[model samples]
Target: MSLREVIAQMRQTMASLGGEAAVLLQRLAARAIRGELRRLAGAGSRVWTPAAARAVVDRLRRMLVRLVAQLGAALGKALTSAAATSLADAALFFETGDRALLGHVLPLRPVAPTPAQIALAREGVFKASLGRFGALLVHAVEGAAVATVLLGKPHRAGVDHVALALRRTAAAHAWELQRIAETEASAAYNAAQLEVLLAQDVPGDRMMKRLVATFDSRTGRDSVLLHGQVRPVREPFFDSHRGHFYMAPPNRPNDRELMVGHRPAWGEVVVDRWPVAEDRRAAPAPAATRRVPGQAIRSAKNLRAGDVLAAPGRPRIASVAERGGRIEVRTEQGLLLYFAAGAAIGVLAAS
Candidate 1:
């Protein structure tokens, strides 16, 4: 679709993503635009580089905030002047925070001027190219939210203009992030998985019956349950104090842990879904030969790091190095140790 269509869709999506999240998206959009502008001046390109994307996002965000203001004004007594004033303050915060993100989270690095100004110039170009994509993500989400809010609900004339805008923007950002992750880490993550399997192939006494791994996507921190079977999540997943990993099962007002099917194994890596679902049926377990929670198992060689050891659990990986024949691992307690190669069983990943 055209750029204008994409922008329109993004705005609708943001409107639906209400609450504090909408505000956050708007804030990021502002930052994204500034970052984009900086890159454009450096590259002399009109194409939607990360910087250009950020610019589009910023436009969407400003428009969303304006829409909110307009709605409040139209509502008249429905919205007090105090409420409007607060919303305006919120908009202002979004802008200021965006600037801070640019300055702190993504700052341009200066390169030494070698061969006079040529090396410096090259460095500048590289920095702008590398840094602009992040800015674009910020822009896309923020802009889409604004557009979505302004457009209001969807209509029968095909898609809701605002929702479509937000979805497209979100899809674009998600695709970009996934692409970067795959390009940079896919091979490495795969290789690491292989090494883990090999380490689990060894045989001996003191060998762990089940090899369990845990990980957090947000902070990129991890833990391992060296000899545990994969279990489904049935109990409360507590948050770790070390801040290395998170386990709060989304946000559910009822305080009931989201339980559907078999419980996730302790330290197993499962997709962290929040809000207890209506259904409680359990699907057939994955083919990876995982024991039910609390069951003991023999050794298998197919397990790998990054492969999800999940059932109803925190989506985790065997976050350890398989150097030589041993699995050098760090436990949840922050203690480092080595496990024999033959102790590990195959892994149960998210299919």
Candidate 2:
């Protein structure tokens, strides 16, 4: 098949899979929230008064509403940049019939859960529990009088009945609170899984196999292979926290290296050459201006701060750095570029 035809087929397949996955995740999240609420409400039925039960139900309603909104936002944001790139790279591999390109495109590792995600989960559970307790307490005192009236007892004797009711209500509330905490933790972990998926890295080997199978079926070819034997080298001076890797090319000099996948041993490297396109825009330029061992030049409007530049003889990759009127270009290997403003320099895109 033609490269364009292959790319079109790949795009269609990826869109279908990504959309299906998204819908499934949304449904699962909705079901989980509903199930938790139902369980809490069922437990609340043991309370002495209807008002107390209603309060518990109402609190659950609010919690679910907030959780849905937060999750929607998170999922939307995750699908945009990193997730999109991963899908595109897989498509590119189909287009070129190159497996080495997979190294640059395929995610090699699953990122560990971030501290922020952990904190968010803990905070969500804590707040949900506190809200449940408050709702129960608000109706606890009124429950006592209602219990007494229903019991047909003297006012002093009714105090004992109210006490007994309170004890039962508290115990039920505690149990429900624990259930909510567990549900929240599960939801958090599921959301994390979704994040990993959106980031273009499937969680387990089984899922990876499924992904490869889908790709092969869509392309009418079984050429694709997943390699788990290779280790990925970390890209230096980049965000190690994100665990980015440089999948080394066989013949390309080290400075022309690609920051493609995440963790290593996740897959095999296929193609060595970076693809360039006229329609594609460069990734968002880096914001910080730092000094490297590169030559300095005057700034120009066409020059972006993070645009990678290559000269005729230099195999090293140089990045544009702008500070006021001065523009400095430096490479990771400490090479400098000395050029005049508006010099006809070639701009390279990140693969």
Error of 2 at 261 (Å): 11
**CA RMSD of each candidate after superposition:** 21.8, 16.8
TM-score per candidate, chains pooled: 0.19, 0.27
Q: Kindly give the number of clashing pairs for every candidate.
A: 36, 9
Off by over 4 Å in 1: 1-19, 26-171, 174-277, 282-351
Looking at model 2, which ten-residue stretch has the lowest summed lDDT? Answer: 249-258
The collision pairs in model 2 are 99-270, 100-269, 100-270, 100-271, 101-271, 109-263, 294-336, 295-336, 295-337
- Model-by-model lDDT, in order? 0.31, 0.37
Tens digits of per-residue lDDT, candidate 1, 1-351, equal: 322232223222222222223233334444444443443334332333344444545655565454334322222221122123223332332234334333322211222221222212223322342245444544556555444443333222112232355445544554333232222121222122222222323333111111222122211111222212212121222222111221221121111111111111112323221111222233222234445664334332333445443223433444567655545543333333344445443234422
- Candidate with maximal TM-score: 2
Tens digit of per-residue lDDT, candidate 2, span 186-222: 2333233334433444344322111111222122111
